[model samples]
Target: MRMNVKLSPEMERFIQGKVASGMYGSATEVIGDAIRRMQAEDERLQAWHVAVRVGEEELDRGEGLPYTPAALDEITEEAIRGMHGNAPACRDVLP
Candidate 1:
């Protein structure tokens, strides 16, 4: 498709250089790539928004279980069980 685009001189030169270096077939290809990146970023932002909404709803409904530990050893043991000696020592957490 033929489209008219007004670019700043610096942007035009950057696109021209990419085409000259064979990184992109033409200025349109570079613009298309930039548009694709913006779209992917938009999708990720949308997913994050949905996650935050779900978290907020859970908080509003008080849907959380409090953690109680009678011994520090239990906390350390639970944290270290799945770790292959590669994780930092767990700290005492209060809830």
Candidate 2:
């Protein structure tokens, strides 16, 4: 497929740099990888929103954990640890 797309000079330079680094083959490959990541993020966000809604509903029905700052922090930390453990190797790219 062929498409005409316009990009700011800065973005063009960024893409060119990625290609020059030998990590990506071409601008199209870089763009496609970026778009795929964006799509995955969108899906993840949608799922998160759904979970939030479900949690809200549970709260309305008095079926959720009691509200406590300490408990919330603990839950958040646990979730983060679980996610990090399950995340792909790409996450290792970060410190």
Q: TM-scores, in order shown?
A: 0.63, 0.73
In model 2, the runs with Cα more than 4 Å from the true position are: 69-95
lDDT (Cα) of model 2 = 0.85
Q: Which consecutive 10 residues in model 2 have the weakest lDDT in total?
A: 86-95
Report model 2's TM-score to 2 decimal places.
0.73
How high is the lDDT of residue 76 in model 2? 86
Error of model 2, residue 4, in angstroms: 0.6
| Each prediction's whole-model lDDT (CA) | 0.78, 0.85
Query: On residues 47-73, what C-alpha lDDT tens digit does candidate 2 reach at each position?
Result: 778878998999999998876999999
Model 2's C-alpha root-mean-square deviation from the true structure amounts to 5.2
lDDT of 1 at 89: 50
Clashes of each: 0, 0
